[model samples]
Target: MGYINIDFTAGCTNNKWENLLHTHSIIQLVNTPTRITSTSSTIIDHVYTNHPENIVETVVPKIAFSDRYAKCITRKINQKDMPCLCHKQIRYRCFKNFDENNFLGDLNKTSFTQIEQIIDVQSATAMWYQLFLSVINNHAPIKMKRIKHVRQPDWLTDEVKEAQKKEKCLPKQRELE
Candidate 1:
């Protein structure tokens, strides 16, 4: 579990954020004093890492295109444990096809004599839960669903593609201008 701290807002004087630096063993990476705001001269933007020894160094690029200074961190990790982990996706029924009449019939078949004879509160609760699950399993059994990915439509015209391209590029174009 690797932890990274990226603070973009003005957090230098904020007591809540400053407390984290003291409580946790995180090391600050951005060192240059000029990385702070020019007008306020406050070190707001920061990047911290728990594994400071693993990191080679941090660099603040020249603010040529944007006001915020982006910090770049380089870390060396053990390659033996670098393989990505994949977990099997689990899918369960959302109970959209639950039959009320079938569920009522199954619940009616449950023996009530055992529950009536229960003296302890915990035992009664457990018996009720077990009976409920048994009824539900018989009437509305859960089904595993398989995921299906839908491909994009190939009927899109050249004009629509051009419009979509323009829409994506509009933000960057506005920022540059």
Candidate 2:
């Protein structure tokens, strides 16, 4: 939601606005002050959502583009509704505990006679693939893992978050000066 310029935290204006929103089943998500000065801090900016339970998190990042901090909300995605947002399940062979010597010994002991005896080229190729797969499976078995995809910006880090906390105080510091 955009700036209503009415402080929703105090007075009759706040009560009327809150009553109207509540009647319509809309809830204000932001609780922190959106704008701050050395003398005062007020919540002028707002975000209203009907499905409050769907909201996972809300943030007010103090960006320098405006006096008011940016309001953002992350909603929980339903896998059936948003297939693209669902976590991916992948199958892979993990080689973390694979022993090279054991693998080599197994490889050396394996018989290639069945593949050699096969007359058809396709059959021989299939047999060779199966034998190779068996050796690989014995050495490093296939594993299944679920990977959750996050949408955070690549540049966002612990250092950047700490810097933003420091940056938020700069405006008030300037006003005081």
Candidate 3:
């Protein structure tokens, strides 16, 4: 496997991670490793600014695996009018806050004070639900069963070949004319 080292020190001051920009005909893989590491400077900025390391670790992984998770999230949120943040780093920030609030699971009774100190329950519930929707958007399950075999290759197995002899034997439509 090849790894690319992203050095923040090499970035221009006032950098907005513009050097990592990619022109994509399909935005499905926006969070892939190449795309994510392009923002190494921003991640380093957060680490130096005293943000929690857990947040950084969690977010960076998501950004790096853009082909897997990024594509999933883009489709889940639909190709409609949802804000861009709902599919990008902004989603990570939202998840961090939601996790801190224990949105996926409840905290132990002893940690009630800790929960109160970090986040309020009122926003916690709504934020938690929003994050849940984000996950659903990004990780939509592939429904392979729903997909019919629309085309078959000539080189496929015997059963497939038996199914469509005409595909190979039929006259070429362009030549026929």
Q: Give the TM-score of candidate 3.
A: 0.14
Give the range where candidate 1 is weakest over 10 consecutive residues by summed lDDT: 1-10
Residue ranges of candidate 2 with Cα displaced over 4 Å? 10-13, 83-177
Model 2 deviation from the true structure expressed as Cα RMSD, one decimal place: 21.6
**Highest lDDT model number:** 2
Clashing pairs in 2: none
Clashes of 2: 0
Candidate 1 wrongly placed segments (more than 4 Å): 1-54, 57-73, 76-85, 91-96, 143-177
Selected candidate, larger TM-score, 2 vs 3: 2
How high is the CA lDDT of each candidate model?
Answer: 0.62, 0.79, 0.33
Among residues 3 or more apart in sequence or in different chains, the pairs in candidate 1 whose N, CA or C atoms overlap within 3 Å are none
Candidate 3 shows a clash count of 6
Model 1 score (lDDT)? 0.62
TM-score, ranked from best to worst: 2, 1, 3
TM-score of 2: 0.44
